[model samples]
Target: MNRPAPVELCHKNMRFLITHNPTDSTLNSFIEVLKRYGVTTVVRVCDSTYDKAPLEKDGITVVDWPFDDGAPPPNKLVDDWLTLLKKKFQEDPGCCVAVHCVAGLGRAPVLVALALIESGMKYEDAIQLIRQKRRGAINSKQLTYLEKYRSKQRLRFKDPHTHKNKCCIM
Candidate 1:
C-alpha cells in the first residue's frame, strides 16, 4: 500500500506525528511506523471511527475527538486536547502523540499548531513549521483562527502532593 509518511513535529518535550487515516491494509505498517517514533497515543479528529483494539494491543492509547472537516476545533475541544497532551507528556516525556484527520492536512495540523502556540511558539511560526513538514496544511478559515489566536496561560499538570504546577508546555 502506498501511504504518505507521517510528519514529525517537535518543540522541546512535545512531539506530534501527523498522518492520514490508515486503511485496514495499511494499518499494520502504520503501527510499525508509530512504534519507531515511540508513539504512546493516537488522536483522531476525523468523523469516522476505526478499530482501536490493534493500537491498544500494542499499548498505544487512542482518543477520538471528531470535528467538522476544514473547520477549526471548538474552544473547549482545544482546551481539553491540550490538557490531555499535557498529562500524557508529564507521564511519559519521551512519548510521541500521533494525530490525524482524514488527510492529516487540515484539522490535524490546526490542532498541532494550536498546541505549539500554547507552548510559546508564535502563531505564524507554528503555521510555517507545520506547512514545512506537512505541505498544504491548514485551510484559510483555520489560518484566520490561528492568526488571531492568543495563547492562554500554558497548560500545566499539577503535582498531586504539593498542589503546585509540576509541568507546563512553556
Candidate 2:
C-alpha cells in the first residue's frame, strides 16, 4: 500500500530542519526563512537513487550527503559526509545544518541525526534533540537508518525490516 507523503518541518535555527519534497513554491518558503534567519549555506542530501534536487545555481554550498530514497547513505558518501561534518563541527560548531531531500522523512533527518552524532552527541540523545529541535524529527524509515547508523550497519545496506511501508514512505 502507498503511504502518506512527508511534510515540511521548520525550526527557528537551521538545526537540521529540512523540507519534505518541497515544491518550487515551497522552496520560496525555505528561501524566505533562510533570508529572515540570515542563513548562508545548506548541506543538502542529493538522492543517490533518483538524482533529483534543486538547480546547482541556487548558490547554496550543496553537500552531497548521498542516500537512496528508501535506504541510508551509501558507503562512499557516508564516509565523505562524515569527514565533511567533522570539519564543519570544528569550524561551525553552533551553525545549523539544513539537511533537505525530496522529503524530510528519509535522507534529510538521517543526515541531521548523523551530524548530531558527529557533533559528539550520543545516538539516542541525537535523535531526541532532533525531535525537540525539529518537531518532525524523523519517520520510521529515517529512524531505521538512524538505528543502523547507530549500530554496526551504518553506511551499509539498509535493514529490510526498517525499510517498511510506514506512516510516511517518502
Candidate 3:
C-alpha cells in the first residue's frame, strides 16, 4: 500500500519527519525527500521484518527500535533511546531525524512526545503539537501514561571512548 508523504514536524535547527510504514515503492522516494530536508538519520520504531532495512550511506544513518503495537516503551528505555538520539543530534546539528511506526499513530507519537518533553516541551503541549501534525497519534492509555509519567533520576549515556556524558532532553 502506498503511504502518504512524510509530514514535516518541527523544523528549524532540528527537523523531525514522521510517517507511516512505507511500501517498497515509497521508501526510496521518502528517503530522497528526507535527504532534501537534510535528514541524515532515521529511527524506525516499528516491528522487525518490516520490508526495508536501514542503510548508512549517502550520509544517512537508519536505526531500528521496534516495539509491539500500543506498547509504550518504559521510561528508562525511552531515556536511553532519547540519549542516543541526542548524541546523534549533537554530533551533527544539521542532521534531521525521522521517526515512524506502523501507522504513525500510537507508538510513533509516544516516542516523539517523549523526545519533545525531554527537550523541554510540556507534556500536554507535546501531545497537542503531535496531534496537530498527525491526528490519532496517541490514544487514551498513552495519554494517561504521559500525564502520570515522571522520572526520579535522569538516565544518561556516556560515550565509552570519550567518557562524555550525554543527557536526554530534560
Candidate 4:
C-alpha cells in the first residue's frame, strides 16, 4: 500500500506553520489559539506596526527576526534562526513552533523549509509541506534554494553535515 503525502500541520506538535498575511485580528486569534495549545515561541520578521504586547499578554515568547524581506537570508542570519529554534525546541521539547513573515511565501517558508530540512525531512517533502501549509508560491530565490537544497542531499538520506555557506551544505 502507498502512504498518502503528509498533510502539513499548521496546527500543533511543535510544528512550523507559516501564515503569510496575518492581520491584527488574525494574529490575535492565532496567539490566543497558541496560548491555549501552550506554544511559546513565535518568530516574526521586522514590522513597524507589530505590537508585542499581545504575545506578552498571552505569555508567548516572540523573537524579532528582521531578515524576512523576500530575500535569501544571510548564512549568519540563518544560523541564528536555527539556533533560536534549537533553543526553543530544547526549552520545551513538547511545544509547537510556528514561524511567520509578511506573506509566508518568502522568508518564513524558506526558513521553515530549512528547519524541516534539518529535521530529517526530504527536500521535496519539506518544500511540499511549506507549499501546502503556507501557499503554492515560495518566491524565486526560495524555489531555487530548494532545488539546490535537495540536490545536495545524499540519496541515502543521511544527515547533512555542518554547512559552510548560506545556500546549502548538502
Q: Give Cα distance to truth, residue 119, candidate 2, Å.
A: 2.8
lDDT of 2 at 130: 57
lDDT of 3 by residue, 27-144 (tens): 6776677778787777777864344453454667767787778877765668667776677666765466788888888887787777777666678998999898787788888898
Overall local distance difference test of candidate 1: 0.86
The reply for model 2, stretches above 4 Å from the true place, is 1-14, 46-59, 133-145, 148-170
Candidate 3 weakest ten by summed lDDT? 151-160
Q: Model 1: clashing residue pairs?
A: none
- Compare candidates 2 and 4 on lDDT and give the better one: 4
- The per-prediction CA RMSD against the true structure, in angstroms, equals 5.1, 13.6, 6.6, 9.5
- Candidate 2 lDDT score relative to the true structure: 0.55
lDDT of each candidate versus the true structure: 0.86, 0.55, 0.70, 0.62
Worst 10 residues of 4 by lDDT: 150-159
What are the per-residue Cα lDDT tens digits for candidate 4 across 56-94?
787777777777576777777777777776666556554
Provide TM-scores for the models.
Answer: 0.87, 0.60, 0.77, 0.70
TM-score of 1: 0.87
Clashes of each: 0, 3, 1, 3
Give one digit per residue, the lDDT tens place, for model 1 in 1-170.
45457999988778899999887677898899999999988998997546778999999888889999999899888988999888887887647999999889999999999988988889999999999988889999999999998888464434455945558677
| Candidate number of the best TM-score | 1
Residue 126's lDDT within candidate 2 is: 66
Please give me the total number of clashing residue pairs in predicted model 2.
Answer: 3
